[model samples]
Target chain A: MPDSSMPAARASTLIVVPAYNEAATLGDVIRALRADWPWVVVIDDGSTDRTAAIGEAAGAEVVSHTVNRGQGAALQTGFRYGLDRGARQLVTFDADGQHSSADLERLLEPVVSGRVDVALGSRFLEVKSDIPVLRKMLLKSAVVFTRVTSGLRITDTHNGLRALSRAAVEQLDLRADRMAHASEILDQIASHRMRYIEVPVHVRYTRHSRAKGQNTLDAFRVLIDYLLARVFR
Target chain B: MNAFQILGISLSSCFAILVVLGVVRRRLRPLPGAAWAALWIAAAIAIAEPDLTVVVARALGIQRGADLIFYLAILGMFIGFFVMYVRMRHLDEGLTAVVRRLAIVEARHRIEETARGEHEASERSPTD
Candidate 1:
């Protein structure tokens, strides 16, 4: 449990959950996060369902977009909200319940201790995660792609679970506005020369999460978006 | 002049006049409007003297005027699409910014409201 006596401590760490039409799992996710972290903000990215209502009911501060921006846009909104509220550390957690609240403490350890600017969760670092075969193959391909493009040696390229220090958060300029933001983030990290670490984390790939996850064809779109951004930038 | 040449030249001339009128009325910006006018006038010239295209194509190492026109049309289309895509991306980024600002402001208001309600509720109740 976080120390509630020190309000500054609570204010320093913020959990940002970017939710899009995950009304079924958002409430539970927020509630679970609120157990350990008091400052939880949910970016309801134009969900047609009751995502915002559920998030608010679960005791999370909910900010809602009027239109359906992609997950990358939602994450950027959450980052801005956290920064505006004077948060020193921001953690991005998936709303689809694939990411566990338990791993958050470990994921945030390096950043909170001022050891590294970012902590990226990697399921491939350890063999504990039971990823589907096709998904695993796709993720491996993405890892190779990131390594070649960004020159960053990391096991996972598309993990949503990450902890960023204030400096890292302020330096990152996320413009992909879609799944391509994952690669974009890594590209920026490499270019900015921010110190980063990879922490082994377990990912629960349930039926619901799998359904919400990206398919094979999205890899190509993400590649195109990343390449176009590079070329234009 | 052939029938097709007369018809094409007339249509292109009408478009060039419209473009000029748009520029004079300030309905279009100077640079882009000038570009449109130049394009229409060039089309008129190409239609009036198809042999000119053949000469230009030969200078460019192309065999036929029709082939040159086809390649130029495709290239122009690609450039047009690229420009539109860049503009669309800028618009998307702007929209995202506006949406993000609204969401943050609304969330702040909601938080303040909740805090005020809690304070009022505490005041209405007896202190321990």
Candidate 2:
């Protein structure tokens, strides 16, 4: 039975964090995301380390897989889990502890207000994310690629923090298995003609995060992957 | 005895030799495409000369040459479909997860951006 008294369906949010091998960072990130929103989910994708155990201890809804399927697969699990738990809006956060959970409130405001179907956290749109110079250049290229492909005017394309509404989540099919899937999601969103916005997102430049992000060689590889996803898909 | 029969024999022999070479080179990965191709060629030759199928099937102790080829070929196709289905599923699972995480990363980044600006401000100017 549909309730006629309900207002235009006020949206609730869940944070989905994908933990690869960041056992050391999982506890802090989960703790922070949960303090603001109780609905914090962590998907531990085939970590040879203690990634799953740490997330579980951090009071997150943990999903673990035995085989390593890549970041894209881990994120898919978190999305389905969050949606099943009655999350009206789903936000994707990194498990590397580079992102601040405090900004989630600002990120959620646009979506909850019904201003956009999707809201992305942009590291380059505002002040610098303290990203390395080479990584910064690579991200700029990724932004251009996404702008051209997705037809979105956002400044940062690869920024990890993004929010999606329930309808948007149901419509999206995030099936790319590797890094390029990041680019693919924008393509899907644009193709579906969903409204989206980019908000200033802050990323901490931890030594470890820098190591995990772009170097000269890795930047080249990311560029190759971004271009190839369109050509191959 | 017929021109068609001679042509059938020649094509079958050529194809079989090529498939055998593929198998020997280790390029053959038990694909059903090759199996189905083999079956069609064998059937074509058998049609050209029915006695040829009987001779081959009997040599392998099969009831009928058509029976033997049909069963083997059917099994091959089932295996191929199974492999293809599994590969498709693997791709689906991988893609779904990445896109979902992307949304999380998007949120977290926004949260972080505002948080850091606040942090910098707090340090620079004390609030009342």
Candidate 3:
């Protein structure tokens, strides 16, 4: 548990974990987060399992969707909840235990210190993690796609680990209710001209995480969804 | 008229009448109802005078009347699909908003309940 005498800034920072049927790993993820962060909210995306129960048992606030609305909607719900509770900073972390709580402070530093409105985690920044060959290729391709489309020049386009200042939180309005929200966030960052930076973070691709993660084909679907959204909007 | 033309015209006329009745009874808006009626009427005319389409097709530089109808049908289907896709996307957004609001409200209630429980527990405890 986080010490009660922790600084107000750390205490006010809300870590939002968007989960869908993550009963196998949510408990450990929340427990690890709660050790350093006081405010941890798990958005259970209509998991028909023990996800919500595990989250509650792990001493984290659990917000549940009545039906599956995808990870994008779940994160938006978490953002609204954190904002309403007067959180000074919000961090989006995955529920698959791929993210490390130890790296969270570094990820939140720029946002908390008011140096940047958004801090994106990039696994490619330091090349510390043993990334799978195929997954690495996919992520690199996504980086190029994001650069061409949003002109952000980011190294990682879809890393779920990120920190947002309150101002950035209020400025972002996510309409993509699925994986495409990652691209949408970058698009908004470019359009809004919000200050942002990338922080090196390690991603653990466990068998469970890899199994739960997006397939190679899903990248095309996300691209189509993103392009169509741009065209339609 | 041929038997197929007679049947096609009869069906189109019935659908056009239904569309007009729908608008009159306030079941559909006037503009959409009018569009539906126009489509049915056009179908009836094409069925009644098949040679007219050949003339129109030639003026449009199309080879055959049947080819013209097929092309028009394909174009119309594409337009219909586009409209439906846009409408479905809007509906999805609306649903996401509703679900997000509900989740936030329920989480707030849960937070309040937990806080109340803790406060009561602390009040009942002896000072260290």
Candidate 4:
């Protein structure tokens, strides 16, 4: 497998991992990422545990949030840091170990090749993960909602893994500090006319990650936020 | 006048006077204070002369003046709650922005400080 150790591969690329109380798993995630990616930054979203220290120990640039500002805020902070340092390519990876580091190459391929401004990982693309029936239904509904609202025909709407170009990242005005930011991002994509593609990437839905995934009630909140955005926009 | 009519008029008059006093004392701004004062004054007038409301209700095709007041009160409450909810949501978004900016700034400062400290420690080593 071709690695990012080559000068061309590592040029101006950054991996941003947003972690919230994932000290038990963040170290492994960061270590695996830092092994291949030269710039890996972990935003510790006010974790009560030793997540920041563990990330630093794993050779990641640790950025700590004084208060828990949710995953969306952490990702925005990471994106700002990457952009401020003149990163040409930025990948948003999960710190919960659900996302595979190997898939990072596939996710970055389209963006790095200049085919798309944003490449989003879709778990349903190849049936690579063990997604429950209920989760599949929920995600499908979200896809339909995105299609209807944003007019963007994408299969997976809320996947956490994505690669974005600097222009696309700069055009993003992320206001949702919570899980709803996924849909919000899609809205911005549609409005800003940013080119985006859904890449076939694998996600390991382990017991730990599924336990930390969005609950059924949180799905209702996302729906409410969508409606509120429409009503208030 | 009947005993209930006299009691209703007296109570509404007292409430209206209290609200006017509040407006005069600068406890409530003029706009909202005037609204409260107008509501209470209207209530006092309607109670003092029930026939007046009946006349207005009849023009509006309402059966009773009290029923019309009840419906208006319910609508007013709904509007009041909706406005308050929107205001609260705006304030919440503003607060989140402020908190997020502070967190990002403080985190950047701390990260820079740690990097500087580590750099100083590495420079002090004599392992050339």
DockQ of every candidate structure: 0.89, 0.10, 0.88, 0.33
- Provide TM-scores for the models: 0.93, 0.65, 0.95, 0.84
The structural similarity of chain B in model 4 to the true chain B, as TM-score, is: 0.77
Score candidate 3 by TM-score against the native: 0.95
The full ranking of all candidates by TM-score, starting with the best, is 3, 1, 4, 2
lDDT of 1 by residue, A1-233 (tens): 12456565455788999999999899889989888788888899999999999998998888999998899899999899888888899999999999899998889889988899999999988638989999999999999988998899999999999999989999998888888889988998999999999999989998999999988888788888888878766
Interface root-mean-square deviation of model 2 in angstroms is 8.1
What is each model's TM-score for chain A?
Answer: 0.96, 0.89, 0.97, 0.94
Pick the lDDT winner.
3
CA lDDT for candidate 1: 0.90
Q: Candidate 1 chain A: worst 10 consecutive residues by lDDT?
A: A1-10
Q: What is candidate 2's DockQ?
A: 0.10
Per-candidate local distance difference test: 0.90, 0.74, 0.91, 0.84
Candidate 1: which docking quality band?
high
Per-residue lDDT of candidate 4, residues B4-54 (tens digit): 878888888888888889989999888988888898889878877888887
| DockQ ranking, best first | 1, 3, 4, 2
Estimate, for each residue in A108-170, the C-alpha lDDT of model 4 and write its tens digit: 988989999999999989757888888889999999988889999998998999999999999
Expressed as tens digits, the lDDT of each residue in B1-128 for candidate 2 is 68887877777777777776777687775574477457657756676778776788788888797876786679978988987866876576555556455544654564568679999989989764
Residue runs of model 4 more than 4 Å from their true location after superposition: A1-11, B1-37, B122-128
Off by over 4 Å in 3: A1-4, B119-128
- Whose TM-score is greatest here? 3
Candidate 2 lDDT, A64-136, residue by residue in tens: 6556666766676677766665778889998887889878878878888888999989887765667777777
